[model samples]
Target chain A: MRAIILEQVDRLLAAQSGAAALRRLEAGEWPEELWEALEGLGLPLLLVPEELGGIGLGWADAAAVWQVIGRYAAPAPVAECMLANGLAAAAGIEPRGGFSSFGQTAPFGRFAAQLLLEPAPGRLALHAPGAATPGQNIAREPRDAMTPGPLLAEGALPNSHGPRALRLGHALLRAALIAGAVEHALALAVDWANTRKQFGRALAKFQAIQQQLAVVASEAAAVSVAVSAAARAVDSRGLEGASFEIACAKVVAGEAAQTTAATVHQVFAAIGITEDHELHHTTRRLWSWRDEGGSERAWAGEIGRNTLAQGGAALWPDITARDIS
Target chain B: MRFELPSLPGGSAGLRAELRAFLAEAGRDWTPAVRARSWMGFDREFSRELGARGWIGMVWPKAYGGHERSGLERVVVLEELLAVGAPVGAHWIGDRQSGPLILRRGTEEQRRKILPGIASGKLAFCIGLSEPEAGSDLAALRTKAERVPGGWKLNGRKIWTTNAHLSDWMIALVRTSPAPEGGSRHAGLSQLLVDLRLSGISIRPIRDLLGEESFNEVTFDDVLLPEDALLGQEGAGWAQATEELALERSGPERYLSSLPALTAGVDALRDVPGADVAVGRMVARLNTLRGMSLSVAGMLEAGEAPAQEAALVKDAGNDFEQRLPEQIRALLEPEDMPEDLRALLADLTQLAPTFSLRGGTREILRGIIARELGLR
Candidate 1:
């Protein structure tokens, strides 16, 4: 089952390589063909329940697809769609899937078929992307802000007054995406360091370059593990209790993505910054994703506040409680 | 590609609960300062208690007093111990590296003699690798041992040897012969087990900034060891030592040293605005570091020598551990903190510098990782 999921994602990512994604972004267009292919594979319904007309995979399994999409910086709302399907499943709504965006403020609002908005906890209003004032994020990705209009469908989620689930779920999604991009960025940096030479020696032969690459590699590795743990937390405990681990994953992965982007790009100097290169696609998305999940400071504040609330003695148990086997 | 994490083994939950129960009672009296030391806090009685439960040498064969548990089980126990600030330091070196090295490389007679003692926690061990001039560069060590009638005679000086003064034995990496012509710098090195109570040996405690005498410098002047004391083959010390360095680098001790301080800071800041986020941020980083470290343990359990990944974990773990004190201070700087929290922070601040210095320095660990990445 894991192999099939990875192979399926790998096939799509190979079809939509980094270069292709970069071109689409540069052309200011979404990859309709890519979205169509993923939707044809029932990709967005991965996290929805089997009873809910979806494959019923856990958040961890669903996250693997997002990681792959982030690896190539796939120019589609695959994450948004997956998230929307998940929310819809939770809300007992069958998402008539196309490219859908779900967030406090959904990006690519102009391209989405339906927007899942959680203005308050437990109450989700499905609506068309109305009044989406056109805007672009730092990465030039479609990020139009919108005031959620009249609901197409609305329901009260049980024990949903607190939006911890949405907040933590978003953090988990962004963490998976950021980790994937950072891993690829590190791989690219390693390739550059090992093959690129200066003064008749490979850049990797230089201690300075090696150190930088090493730092990025560590960051990438750290982010991957953290995201994996967070995914597991969500898989086991649901969002209500998993927020601490999710917030941790977000802060750690977010911090790592920022450092990794700077270090990996700096290792390439001018070449990485060029439009002809696909490295920017991953780095730009990293920049966007890190900020998307409330940024490091935002999540850090949540974690800090949670820890402080527990008092000093209970801190160990809080951390140990997440030690899943 | 190797970054894919391995799954934690089954039965870890049961082991974790057992350890937690033990820790709750054992560490009931430990203050934050005692907890701040975490794995570095030594208590002979506590170590023996763990040994009695067969937690030490858990992966070795049952014949050697081991419980024959899986590597992941050992990781679970160790992680719980460090997380709860258990004082297992008296037997930490033995359980973590020395005993494992002996079990793998020691002869039947040597294992029979040493392994049971370690497993019983009756024996304590300390590393004798670093010299005054050979901190990061192990091959540059000048410690020498020469063939003698019944065994070998050793002469060397080891610095920054943790717990050497308290340990019953020392595992010394010595130059058995001069480096061969045009040979690897690592040639002719051997690991010899030395009786710390040998007549010719002397141990002097070296105080750190925290005024702790846990670090020591030891001198060996013509100490004699039995023939079987040689671990593995002579001149195979470098390869042998490198294999277990993963065990040293990937343990929870690498990251959880400063957690007590952070947790205390969390308690102190509970009523402060935004304290959840502030303390939560540090907790989040720590949880991630634990995940990364646990992944290394998984790799080790699969019998894959993930030296580079272990290096990555240690490098990342050290950075997190070292920065934690300062990060907590920065987060809670505006608020007037309690006295206990203030004291914990001060202690952690002083000890944080040692995080990257011990095991392998950050530069060296990164260099190893870079080399493994095919970068060097």
Candidate 2:
């Protein structure tokens, strides 16, 4: 990672800043200062390219930065901002201020600064990626287990309704960020292992603990390597490798992060589950990070689609081409 | 990186094709039932056929009866056999690795005597490392091998010796010396080729939770062997065992147990519902995993030990594989699934529980991964 990224990451983590300060961010709104400070570092403009007044780093460097920020359990839009900005730049549009979410159409387009509908709209048309609803949710009532929500982008956004384009940049960036989060979870587990003790000795000495931690560490490292490698390949091979590489990397990393977070929390014993333990934040961040990127199943499904389309054999070279680097 | 299913150099493709044809024909009648395809599910006939093609001992030189093919090429063969669910338990240990170990470390006579039969697919072998109490704790092993006139006399019970009752020979870890306080307890465990058929040895089947008898508990009652039985060197078993395990503990076999159920489900639905969508996802995951796996194999072919990389493959691949059963549950059970699919899922759920256990537990797998990351 670049020293600048690390410095910026450390500065935020130094204060445990952002929505992290809120007791229940899963339900609460994001803070204003955190967003302002993040933009001040040009985080939102990261993918804007130097030509677009942004400090454009390669995906590997970007992934590493995301991992560091993830370790601190920062809020959603930090990395998301970077990705949306990149997409805006790629579309050759100068952004005013708006965020983009990928996948099928979001109803309200809450974060969308402007809609680049898959089917480019004709003049005087306010289009909608039609029939776009949020992922299936629990029935709303006291009779059922209703998930608390000020749901982000729940209903349709005015007249804009139709099928949408797959935002490749958003997908790729989310994968990278998720991979980074998995790496972060592994690190948190390692740090916990070093300091946490049981039976009058450091817990790191336990065979069960060591092996689990090692697996988590290895997974994150390998995926981190793979994701970065894929990112580099994107430059050389264009989009071919990036999709599969990022998809594979993200799915692997996401699964690892999900499992590792639970495993680490388990190893931390009862204290880890409490709201105040430092470990709580690690797992919480992992939770949010995964939801932000969709679930592992979603990404795995995408990977399967891309992979089957390319056939298994093309995957290696597809991501390893000269354009990827 | 994506991996191309490489054609074998020279006549290797022909050999793979021949093996593929043989397995396809042999398994034509195989259903989820009547097929034990566990460690004991090895096909002696298939082994003999592979021997006939001179495909075994593939990584070694020709002097010892090996085909001298590249490891990368051999990976394709290994993967296909496991993927196709071929009955390869008979000669798997010998063909896949024991032959290479003996060729690498055994004397001329040892290589000549062992390698030829292995290549020809006549000989069979099994590993003996775990004990009744030391299944995952290799350092806790109490099996002792004492020095004697001609060679060492082994006396101790070896537990979880896969297919020991059926094996002709064994590559076993026996304690030759004791560990002092805080010493490397895993040290002094020598690896030797213990002839299982020799007198005074007892093999007992340790039925797994699946009711399969692939694992065994073998007690060596002063089992005698000549000086030549010592593999590599005395007191070198720990490293040798670790090396062999690096081969055993990783590979497509580590995670491909669910492949059959996956294949069956996909085939059943291929003509039905949106099979294209479902199959594509599974194929993509398998492809990426295969890519990573092949890269490790390439590293091994280039003489780079890919233990950690292989561990990553095993962990991720197994996790991915395990999820396949869960993924297609709905399609399989459309209005409450078929008996076959239910049984298939049940079978996979039962048998694949220890995908991470037989070689090394999932925790052990993780330790290897973490260490590679410089975190521990």
Candidate 3:
């Protein structure tokens, strides 16, 4: 299964090279081919039940796909569609085929055929694009906003874990994305160190560069491990006891994204800052995703409140007692 | 991908509960200051009690006094021991690396002699890797073991040898021969097991920042050993040391050092304004570190040498543990802190500086990680 995921990822990345991706972003192209390829692979419907004509992959499996998409900085609604299909399933709405976007404010909102929204707790609704005021995240990917009114279908999201779960799920996916991008950034840095020579030796041989790249590697490893924990927690507890893990994972991912992106840029120096260099593809998404689900600082506060609420002796157990089911 | 941190295997839950029960009973009287030592707190009686319960060397073969438990079982025991701040330090080095090294490299006689004692917690071991002049550059060590009639005559000085003053034995990496013809510095180094009680060996304590003498400088002058003292093939110490160092660098001990203080701080400041935010951030970071550490444990269990991944964990773990006290202090109002909490903070603050210096220094760990990344 992982091999299949990796193969699909390789194909997608090959199709949308950094040059093609940057061109699409610059030209404000809709990434139609990218979306088409992902849809062809049924990547977005991974979380939906097999009964619903979906693959029914678990959270970890979907997250693996997100990690690969994040690595290539593929500007598509892959994460959103996965969440939307799940949300629609919970709401007793049959998710239609096409690009679907779900969030407080949807990404690629203008391009989405259907937008799933939770304007308030327990309320689930679908809306046409209606009007998507085009906006871009820090990475210049689409994060357009649309008015919540004039819903095409509206009802209470029965059996749903509620808006918080959706948000947590999105946060978890973004963490995976940032993790993937950091993986790319670290690879780039390693390649630069090995190939870019100075002082009659590879930059990698220098202690300074190695130390910096080591930090990047640590950050990458941390986010990768952390996101898995969060994914597993949500899978088992259904967000009832998942907030702590989710918040912690988000904070770690956010902080890692910031630190690693900056450090990779420092390692690459002048060339890293230019758009022509592919480092920006990953680094910029890192900048954008760290803030997307919720900023690290925001999640830190959430984690802090939860910890203090649990009081003293229950703290460690709460951490160690994560659901492995 | 299956690259995710694998969940704990079955039977670990029962082991975790068993350990928690034991800790609740055994650690009832442990003070916050003592608990702050975490894995470094040494108590021989406590260690022996754990051994009697078949906790130490839980995964080794039964013939060598082991329980033949799974790696996750051992992880559960160690996790509980560190979490509640048990005094496992008496057998920490032995059970963690020394016993494992001997089990892997020692001859049948050596294993028979050493393994049972370590599993029983009656024997303790200390590492003798870092020398005064060869701290991070271990291959540059000048410790010489000249070949003799019966065995080897050892003469060298080892610095920062943790628990040396209290240990019964040591696995010393020493120079057995000169650099090879091709100038490979790692060649000709070998691991030698030395009895701390041997004549011509002196151990002097080095006071750490907290004024505790957990570290020592051991000087060996013409110490004689039988042929059995040599571990593994001669002139292969570098490879053996690499494996030993991996075990040393990857354990939960690396990041759990300052956890006691952090936990106490959270308890004391539970209702304080914005306390959650501070405690939450630390918990988040701690959870992440724990995940990374456990992943490494899983890798080891699968018989994979994730040396670079282990190095990454140690580098990050050291940084997290060292900064924990200061970060917690900044989180809470100083004047509002209780006396017990303040003492923990102060003790950890004093001990924090040594966190990165021990095992492998941060720079050296990072260098190893970079080398694995194909950077060097």
Quote the true-contact fraction of every model: 0.90, 0.22, 0.82
The 10-residue segment with the lowest total lDDT in model 3 chain B: B1-10
Clashes of each: 15, 34, 1
Scored by CA lDDT, what does every candidate get? 0.81, 0.62, 0.82
TM-score of candidate 2 on Cα atoms, chains taken together: 0.70
Candidate 3 Cα deviation (angstroms), residue A264: 1.7
Model 2 per-residue lDDT tens digits across residues B172-282 = 888888876688886677888888888879999988887878788899898888888888887788888777776765567766666666655654554444545565556
lDDT of 3 at A106: 80
DockQ winner between 1 and 2, please give it: 1
For model 2 chain B, give the 10-residue run with minimal summed lDDT: B1-10
In candidate 3, residue B9 scores what lDDT? 73
lDDT of 1 by residue, B1-376 (tens): 2655556677767777888887888878988688778777778888888999989999999998899899878988887887766778889999999998998888998899999899988899988889998999888999999999999999989999988888999888999999999989899999999999888899999998888898999998988887877889999999988987978998888888877677567666666665666566667777777777877787777778888888888888899889988877875773477777787788778878889999999999999988888888
- Which window of ten consecutive residues has the lowest lDDT sum in model 2 chain A? A137-146
Question: Which candidate number would show the highest DockQ if scored against the true structure?
Answer: 3
Per-residue lDDT tens digits for candidate 1, residues A146-260, read 7666677765544531465566677788888888888788888888888888899989899999898888888777777777777777777677667777777789888898899
Ranking by lDDT: 3, 1, 2
* Model 3: CA > 4 A from native: A148-163, A323-325, B1-3
**CAPRI tier for the interface of model 1:** medium
Candidate 1 ranges with C-alpha deviation above 4 Å? A51-53, A129-131, A146-166, B1-25, B28-33, B331-337
Query: Candidate 2 docking: what grade?
Result: incorrect
